[model samples]
Target: MEREQLIVKVCGMRDAANIESVAKLGVDMIGLIFCRTSPRYVSMVDSLAGFMPNYTVNQLKEMKNPSKSTDIKVAPKRVGVFIDEMPQTIITHVYNYRLDYVQLHGYENRIMIENLRRTIEPDIRRNVKFIKTLHVSTLEDVEEYKDYEGAVDMFLFDTSCRLGGGSGQKFNWDLLKQYSGETPFLLSGGIGPEDVDNIKNFNHPRFIGVDLNSRFEIKPALKNIDLLQEFIQSLRK
Candidate 1:
């Protein structure tokens, strides 16, 4: 497949400068974590375990806008990561952040996913995509989510850990060879600069993209733009 055909998503971004820098690199999607327990959570906090600071919806809006100093146009879709949040809360945040996609990183049932899709306004619903995260330790784990093929727009394969994600650990990619379901998936979990060669060797017709997070971060929610740029360039080459 051509380099442009592969979608690239940089997840767990919070710092505005870093967000814009990555966006300028032409990533296909930017993920902002909404799960409170995650170190990369984007809401009302400046540092790890700090007091809840007030954040206005405008912060999200600002990130989407172009920088005044440059004409760099960032066209990446904004994705919000949530963990078992209520349908209403998801819907509210979707609009508030102007998210183009919602990544469900919790153990939500089919009913909950359907309810979320049905509840969002038709206008927004038509454009928004839903991604269901599957924590994989075995091939059976991938098959178990087959029922959600129709409910979610895509599947994210992440390492199974005590916490939902940001485990900074990788799953067995060979396990995905057993996935027979037609749903396309984004390969995530501990993907960093060093994985470019392994990623290039990974061949699966249904593998549509890759999501990078913890491994590329200078700290939680702060990505190393230089490393990310090199990774992106390597992928293109």
Candidate 2:
């Protein structure tokens, strides 16, 4: 299926103001790192729910608390970026935060993603989406994951490294030609302010978006809003 518009996701958002700033730019999604090891981890916050925008009361009534209220000015979809987290722990965040998407960046297989998603509460799970990350170093790295085609809502292709992604390095973009599956993918890694023209020129039927992280950051978890605004404006046009 062809997407109406390409997705522009700005990941690793932690600060309350920074998150609001990026959301105001009208990006499609905002990602928060749940992996503790990453310097951009959002777990340090006093309350994750309070730090993020509130989910509609209609979705999960019990998860809503006045103390958890935030003033994010835009409605970008919220995504919890996880690295091999337990099923129960992930389930709790989905309930507590009402995340719209769960992005998995690990060695998890299709079965793991499927089963973990099934373990979520039915009402909340129905509103959630899953994005599986593929650290691409070689063509086979993507070609071999054909089974994930239907299991995930989307796929993220990033430079292969020990940390999974956020290496601020680009892999051989041509390696994507090997993938001919139905699942759409987001191109990430080393996407900086200068890549707007290149990202626009690149084309593939399944390419649906771009994921920005390290290159757009002022620090690990803080994004440069001015740079982001300029880049997003250019990419969208």
Candidate 3:
């Protein structure tokens, strides 16, 4: 986390205004959960008066490189977080939401990831990047990173627990030291405002960022912007 400009991905985002506010915070990415079982699910939202229905790629682009925003120059990159879903299902979401990244957060295989990647529209292919999640608890799980080496654009190492999707728990970070893979990754699971000191001290060659969720939320998908502002400012300091 001490590395200069380490990316910050604020995940499980739901509210429209809240998403915009967080984008103004200069976060690198904002993730919307697509898993039906997830409380932060986007389907119930986007079909109605939520983000996907109103927010479009042009609007997203404007948010990113806005000419008049004092808060941040670029908006947070949009990401669609999915479980083990069909390639066509993923394709529809990617096209509908205009996501910048797709976080595969289930027991997805390399073929599944590659197929989805290859199936995306040729024009949209360049704009989308895939992030595969590696739920870690022990050395055995960490070593599985190699199996996904050539499939994804990046890896997200989250905590392994029975209660999935925003399990507010942390795995032993020391386990990541054993990950000898080359793909850069975002450290997830149980990260909070309190981790600034620990995150600043933690260093890795391929470690690129952090994924904030349950720990920073006021409820299922509502984030405490004040707390996040303090955390980001303090961490960057």
Candidate 4:
């Protein structure tokens, strides 16, 4: 197997302390859940227990064009994870928060993905990349998403959970190795600190990243940064 850039993405981050730890670690991306139906939803006034100073979108925006050297450090490219949200609603957050990526985890068809892309094309400020996800129960499910290969910038194959993503249970890795597509994808599902060796052993050209969710969580919305740090460090080794 040839060595490739292994991207580590820490997902479902709720508060600031974990976010800062992840940012400082220089992971590729961090996901903030927007789906209210999911147990991992991070709402307004969510506790800042572990964070240095709490901030909202408007507050962060004011510091964006910092006049003082003490302006708050812009955190990792904020990624909003949505499932079945109205395109307009997604647009609102994307523009308001200056999001870097919109990860669609619902049953959004190819048309929806394209429409979302076209919706923000005229407005540079709202331009955000789309990452479509597919739930994998079998190798056939992986094959089913080929038509969408070119429609999305990246594909996230997560476990088939009752409520959709955030399930820490992993699917079959051998099935993923059989995937014959050109679209680069992230392997998600029940991935934990122990999965590092398994991932390193698996060989595939299109394997781009790993999505960590429940396995790295202390609770629904909180994360254990040490688990993530160990996992990431192991990848580097």
lDDT, model 1: 0.82
| Ranked candidates (lDDT, high to low) | 3, 2, 1, 4
Show where candidate 2 strays beyond 4 Å: 1-4, 55-74
Give one digit per residue, the lDDT tens place, for model 2 in 1-237.
433567999998888777777887888898988888998887735363567644344224434654554443347888999898887888888887668899988877888888877777375566588998888899888875686878899999989997777889999898888788888899998899999988887889989899999999888989999999999888887
lDDT of all predictions: 0.82, 0.82, 0.84, 0.78
Q: What is the lDDT of residue 197 in candidate 3?
A: 90
Predicted model with the maximum TM-score: 3
Q: Which is the better candidate, 1 or 3, if ranked by lDDT?
A: 3
Candidate order by decreasing TM-score = 3, 2, 1, 4
- lDDT for residue 131 in candidate 2, whole number 0-100: 93
Residue pairs with clashing backbones, model 1: none
- Show where candidate 4 strays beyond 4 Å: 47-75, 122-127
Whole-model lDDT for model 4 versus the true structure? 0.78
lDDT of 4 by residue, 22-123 (tens): 666667888888898888776655633433233455356566855633233444567789998999988887875567888998888898889888987668
lDDT of 1 by residue, 40-132 (tens): 877754434332222233345456753533323556788989998888888887876778899999899888888788877485555788999
12-70, model 3: which lDDT tens digit per residue?
98888788778778889999999888878877545577563244454675678797444
CA-only RMSD, every prediction:
4.7, 4.7, 3.1, 4.4
